[model samples]
Target: MAESRSKLVIVGIGDDGLAGMTESARRIVAEAEVILGAPAMLSLLDGLSGRKEALEPDMPAALRQVREALASQRAVLVSGGDPLFYGVARYLCDRLGKDQFEVIPHVSSMQLAFARVKESWEDAYLTSLAGRPLEAVVDRIRTAEKVGLFSSDEHPPNRLARALLDRGIDYFRAYVCENLGSPDERVTQAELTDLASMDFDPLNVLILIRKPNRPDQASRAGRHRLFGNPDDMFAQTLPKRGLITQAEVRSIALAQLDIRPDSVVWDIGAGSGSVAIEAAQLAYQGMVYAVEPEPADVALIEANAESFGVPNVRPVPGRAPEVLASLPDPDAIFVGGTGRQVVLVLRSAYARLCPGGRMAVNVVTIDGLATALETLKNLTSEVQVWNISIARGIEQMDRVRFEAINPTFLLAVTKTPDVSD
Candidate 1:
């Protein structure tokens, strides 16, 4: 009769390794027939009497090796810090099934790093850079008051600090914790600018604590109003600056677009592509075609897309109606500046839209609205027009006063299958 396979135990160790482990955890490691871990982890169990196996540098292969070993004898897979908090234990559980192993966790390095910095982590944005793109975690950190990052070999603290600083994100006080709980453990704190020039151990957690009173560090609403973001929030062409769609108008148009994560959209007359960029972010998996006629505006759109890191936006450098031919049909469309060609663009866009697709046209004057409404009446049966007037508060002589922006008209039309014929 074959011997029964022993259960796999995944144990988390602090920077102190076995010395910091609980007695029960130590006993489990000592009794294991096969011990699998990185060299650093293996060094912790130097005198242990077991069939010691060094884990591969590659995580997936190491996990595979661990699973094969689990079929024969009792094994302990050792990892540093909390096994589940951006650690290997979660990956193991996910790949091998939760029932296949028991996980023993220790304090995560993120928690230790935050503790070292004397900051509460309940609200911090936590992520790991290991085997992942830095851009994958940047958006979450962009507005977070606190951020905890498990720095990897490829994307270390210095690189991350530099990336953040380069993107005008200088609101955080960076703290790097190296070898937490070890005798040589060190926690270094500095401004993000200062951190970009420094170096630290490979095994480190990078904590970003937002500096007090920093303008960009404030909460979303505290920093700026919801509807009308500052014109500088977007990238615009130099010579044709301020020609981009107005914030109030874009806000109302976005609302009419009814944007969601799955929305497929088109921004005709994309200008600097503010609406298209924001819409792309809101509609993550969905597509946003930024159709612009001006080459400078198209270049600005590309620059804006890079800064925002929104991959969903496709900047098409050409006039609409003609360019709309090659693109996928949109769920919604926003016409920012159509001039006298407003009716023609709407008619073409309406025909290209899938049934139930929405199209919103922003008109600064009543004449433009009349043209759009007339075109909508001919194209589809239902059209809703809204005149949006926004007043932004300005602080003057210690008194707050409302500054009313130019009112704009938004005409929203929904296409119907029956209207096509």
Candidate 2:
């Protein structure tokens, strides 16, 4: 009768091989009657009496050897990094059974790559190109702040870079970490265009960190809406971030403004410049002034402006009413809010609005809305009022959730031509 097989041991090896493995892994390899691993991994086993077996190209062939060896001999299989992390161990365990294997994990190359780059991986979008389709990978990477990919021979760093570039996803800085845990280890950092034009070792980990405040380098296909982008798409000021004009209300307010190609617009209390930036897109031939009191918010406005590639938007730092003096009288104006002085700011801003120009105000509180209504009514007999309540759909698991945005009111009025002397 054949001897009963004990559990097969799967040890994760690194580029450094034997010297880098733990004592337990070394001892397990020493005692094994049959060992299986890639040619490079098997070459690391020195001074061992165990029968070394090179892995077959296919999983079934490798499984046959493991099963046959385990019947009369102790079996060991080696893989690079954590065997279950986009490695061979997962397939073997899934094909056979969990009870048949003991897995000893090593640091995955993705983890090592991020460590080499000195960046955090907690929020990174990580995956292996060895199994994923390149098109799917690029789509996932479009909005990611950081990404890590295990580059395979078929989809090496250069090939993957070309794929990204062809799709116009060029906003990230790329790092290719090669031969991790080995003396010949090299980390090459460059722009995606440079990476696409260069070559790299097949044994490499590719990492990408998105540039600050960058919008998608290329436009999404079928995306025709030029304004009122989702709120998260814009860079906002912290602590008071939710102050952004909601996309729904922004669209409505912009419509009310009746902006023209040469319309000079003002976004008072710009609050990270969402309104100002979109308005700038509308008035590309014109100019949009983004006014804010907070210095930090002003910085965000500038960053957001450049990120959106709208040089026409100007971020003016100072409170409204006072700063309004420096700006050219606007053909259109959007008042996000001006604290307790919403009424006061509106009065001053309306005074400078061009004849037949339009102005829109966004107010969140009922009391503030009331104050705006009275103020605007005094300025013009005609006012357009809208109560905007929005909820974004968020799908989790199989169920869907509607995230409600705070309901807000918009007051828009046109400065009557006769009254505008």
Runs of candidate 1 with Cα error greater than 4 angstroms are 1-3, 217-421
The digit string of per-residue lDDT tens for model 2 on 1-421 reads 9666688889998998878988988888888888889898888787789988899866557767877766745788989899998788866775466778899998888899999999999999888876444554676688799999998877888888898888888889999999999999999999988998888877899999999988976544334246989888888756776778888888888889999866789999888998888887777556899998888888998898777767678889889898887776688999986887877899999988877799999989999999999999998899999999988899999999999989999989988665222
Model 2 earns a TM-score of 0.52
lDDT of 1 by residue, 318-400 (tens): 88688887776677898886655777788889887766678988878888878888989998778999988878899999899
Per-model clash counts, in order, read 0, 0
What are the TM-scores, per candidate, against the unseen true structure? 0.54, 0.52
Say which candidate scores most in TM-score: 1
Error of 1 at 44 (Å): 1.8
Candidate 2 residue pairs in clash (backbone atoms < 3 Å): none
How far is each candidate from the true structure, as Cα RMSD in Å?
12.7, 23.9
